[model samples]
Target: MTDIPSSLEDVAEACGTRAALALLAHFEGIDLYFPHNPRPDHPILQALGPEDGPAVCHYMAGETVTIPNRSPAKRRARILALHEQGLSTAAIARKMHQTQRWVREVIRRAGEDDQGDLFG
Candidate 1:
């Protein structure tokens, strides 16, 4: 809720008792107790909010790997193109040098079947 718009124009929320009960249930499931301010640094009453920062990626493994230069949209388009070219998930994974799971996920995220066929 930190970035909630001033007018809530871009927000979608349920507006009744059911919504209140749903929120309470969600908080209970996530262990968010009432009166708890987990992000004390970001008090709700603060006049100014935190600044947007640059995105950073860190390397974990000892092996050196080159990160791709293309943005995510480009990468997803490439995946979809390959899928349209009738490549099997395994074949796409091999051609893209990505895991079969990753290939499947890309297809799924692009609203396609596990077999890489686009769904209407």
Candidate 2:
């Protein structure tokens, strides 16, 4: 099953998990062109900031990369797992590069799903 994770494993190895996840969070399902020599204002730099941007751009210089899409079920499962691990909604959102409201909604929906059919 293809997902954001599998797609980014190589990038994670090349850079780091945080940088890869940052790319996924910012540019998923988009085609990003990495210039051979990028300026400070490059989109990748903009997304990953100064700390990670240079490394990623250096690794992928002169390439047009197609960022993968996040699988919904996998994403939900990950959210649940992180929540189970005692990470707060804000932490999960930061780790997953999502909004706290979105994380809360996912948790709430998972709870509803776990309850099953009430009238059945």
Candidate 3:
């Protein structure tokens, strides 16, 4: 019998019930490609010594290839604007939508009242 490489496959193979639950929690209602802004300070990325971080591969509307950060609030806001236009969640879901959960979240965030301004 041959021993497996511990580094690559060990973490995945050792993902027991707790790990599975954690994975579900981490990914639930989140887009892997377009994660929420301000990632939770990834230690690994920091440890990589900061050479502009990992490059993401993305395909844009014009079929152009681009690498973008996980969270681009400008683009997200554009999608939110559409949601605020009385468009159905499904409609918004079809357009800029990556996931239904993400669409709903955008709508919810857009609908929030400007309470912050009142405090100021």
Candidate 4:
């Protein structure tokens, strides 16, 4: 679960994985402004609560940050898991915020034999 995107590496290193993931989940694909002096009502604070909020503030005070919405490896794993669970490509696409073609492609790619694995 600590497998955070590289963009959030500094935050994850500074604050820990839970905090970084929380930030990612809440603020992915959006530019978020973290105030130097975060008020009690700041969204970061509200989302992360007392334990992690100040840690993030201490790390990146007065910064505007955008967490990436997609982690390629994570997305692939999710797609495969959904596929294994008997979800249709269209349903998986809708659920994962991806196009059906993309879902199908991931599914197809996952089933391909890995050339490198033969040596192992």
Highest-lDDT candidate: 4
Per-residue lDDT value at 103 in model 4:
91
- Pairs in clash, predicted candidate 3: none
For model 1, give the 10-residue run with minimal summed lDDT.
Answer: 52-61
Model 3: per-residue Cα lDDT over 1-120, one tens digit each: 022222213222443333323322333223333222324465222322233212111111112212222345764786778876887767766665356677787667766754467556
Residue-level lDDT of model 1, residues 1-120, one tens digit each, is 332222221111323333233332222112212222224343221211222100010111122223222245665677789999999999876666567887788888777334553574
Q: What is the lDDT of residue 102 in candidate 2?
A: 86
Q: What is the lDDT of residue 17 in candidate 4?
A: 88
lDDT of 2 by residue, 1-120 (tens): 133377677778888888888998897656778787788888789999998899988888888777876776787788899999999999988777567898999999988878968699
Report every candidate's CA lDDT: 0.42, 0.82, 0.41, 0.83
Best-to-worst ranking by TM-score: 4, 2, 1, 3
Lowest-lDDT window of 10 residues in candidate 4? 111-120
Residue ranges of candidate 2 with Cα displaced over 4 Å: 1-4, 72-120
**Clash totals, every prediction:** 0, 0, 0, 0
Q: What TM-score does prediction 4 earn? A: 0.56
In model 3, where is the ten-residue run with the lowest total lDDT? 53-62
Ranking of all candidate structures by their lDDT, best first: 4, 2, 1, 3
Q: What's model 2's lDDT at 21?
A: 86
Find the candidate with the highest TM-score and give its number: 4
